[model samples]
Target: MNKTFKIYAVIFIIIMVILALFEVNKKEVTDWRKNFDVNQKSPFGLFVFNKEAKDLFKNNLTKIDVAPYDYYTDKNKKPHNILILESEIDPESWNKILDEVSKGSDAMIIANRLPKNISDTIGFYGSKISYENENVLKLTDKKYQNDFIKLDKFPSGRGFSYIKPNVQILGKTVEENNEDQANFIKAPFGKGKIYVHCEPLFLTNYYLLQSGNVKYAQSVFSYLSDRETLWFVESNTKESSSLLRFILSNPALKYAWWVFLGGLVLFIFFNVKRKQRIVPIIEPLKNTSADFVKSIGNLYLQEGDFHDMMAKKAQYFLNKVRLDLLIDTQNLDEEFAKRLQLKTGKSAEMVNEAIVLIKKAQDPYASVMKEDLARINSLLDEILK
Candidate 1:
């Protein structure tokens, strides 16, 4: 049943994806973006542009997706062209764009934001966004000065002012205010001219589907020559080592990457290195005196040091006699032997015999016999008792 459910889920997902691929929203509104992704149908997305921008030029038309620096290096002279950058371009790319433009080529940069260098190069200013409502662009074109080119369903334009005299304000977006600030600008810099549009949402699918909006887009393109290459500078074209971008570029692989990352973190967290119980420190049993004496006896027997062992035992016995009985053990004489006999209450003959055996064992070359050692132990035990 589980396998069958998984199979059904896979089939359902496939069907949903296929439906989404072919689906079109005919009456949907309010989806807007200043982005140029063709997959999106947002106000500033390139879905409409990708479909219609090629139609703007039929003869000698070339559309390339290359950076400004690459374009500058490859092409000998920049042509009368239209460049649409949908995001904030870096200084290097902006400089390259200016360099190409100043060499007699015309460019229309459609962006909501510009790099500071370019903004300073062109006098740009902004007022507080007082209008939250959708807006339409009012064209104040130099070519068509008397006529008004106004269209609706465009995203609300920002209120901004610009330096004039040398700068030509070509278009203004009408919002809640009576007169919107200049959102479209045409200016001359160095050897050529540049046209900048602040409201890029006009080129999106949101308004292009509106009546006469596609024609309005064409009219905007009319400012540039139809003979040159159209470079569509995509968003985030700057050098960004963005993992999010990689995941976004591969929809199917995004889930796989997330799973792998989560699994790895869990493996590190739960499967902690190696969980062995703290093995108790079982210290070996401490050596007792009996064991120590036994060890020493074994060593003596092994090395044939029986005479040394016997002398140590006799010296220990004499020390006990002097300490316990208060008897003089300085000399093993007849007087000492008589005193030991009285203290032990053993016979005088037995005491004298034990003294002789101990003296014989004390000699370094004396052969130690077990029976003789036993007799000495008996006498020492009697003295101890």
Candidate 2:
């Protein structure tokens, strides 16, 4: 890979490593949203409640993931107490739940608010009470009225603002001003009862982790009849809408996600570096024939060997004529000059002069000079052209 790309890849890795370390070491912010997922350990989740469900139900709790309508539609399934948390029941599910409750199956719904249909059908409008300071939660029964628990934080919710006479108030939020707002209620349907509580926060991990809040949850369950409890564990919450949220909701999965991303980046870096290496440039070999010939010419000129140089030049010309023009140069006669002039398209005079110079240079007794060499070279060049 090129130097610029390697530098960018290294910077990306360093940034990812820094992010991983920061995420691993930073103090985790508490999520206060009332998601109430059974497996989540967030403050508003139900992990603690789910873990303590067996104790609350006397080892009779069974988790169901389907809608209440589907769960009750099964003929083979026996009637059980239905427990719903942090959900708004649809009309179909509510009708099915009502049918089950009328047929002797109790259902307890705990949420911050209830749907309009359910609220109208149950004869209560779910409400909230915002207190600027912390409050106490307790059962409204004479036996547990004084057994109130102090909330570490101000409660963000209350209960029904209005209820029909048929719905009996079971619990209330005692504010600092002694204003008791009903947060829990029960209504009977046929042979079974339907318990509705507005403040679902009381049963979340945050509240349940408190020293005495488990007792409050037990008290809430006490309002339901003793039976096999089917806890509806829903996976359609906002937190479960995307895989990213699911991964981030769990510490182990979140860590693994970051690690997988880092590994993927590293794999790309090494793989590209291995496959996209720098390619070296190769230069073509140079032609040195001209330089070698020039050096030999200089040496002959320095040695004053004009006769030998002229003879060799004339022989080279004859060989070139035999190879290129298919002409025999064994004799420098007038017939040879005419044939050479016709073949080379040169003047008869230049061809004849070149032939005469070649014969004189080739003669052993004739003396050759630099002037004769220059004249033969000029005549030969003209004839060849």
Clashes of each: 0, 0
Error of 1 at 300 (Å): 6.6
Q: What is the lDDT of residue 121 in candidate 1?
A: 80
Q: Residue 107 error for model 1, in Å?
A: 2.4
Query: Where does the lowest 10-residue lDDT sum fall in candidate 2?
Result: 232-241
Clashing pairs in model 1, backbone N/Cα/C closer than 3 A: none
Give per-model CA RMSD.
9.3, 13.4
Q: Which regions of candidate 1 are displaced past 4 Å?
A: 1-44, 47-84, 115-117, 123-132, 140-154, 175-177, 227-234, 237-306, 313-357, 364-385
Error of 2 at 367 (Å): 71
lDDT of 1 by residue, 145-197 (tens): 43333445445556455555788877777666566677777888777778888
How well is each residue in 278-322 modelled by candidate 2, as lDDT tens digits?
789999887799899999999998999999999998988999899
TM-score for each model: 0.56, 0.62
Q: lDDT for each of the candidates?
A: 0.68, 0.80
Alpha-carbon RMSD, candidate 1: 9.3
| Highest lDDT against the true fold, candidate | 2
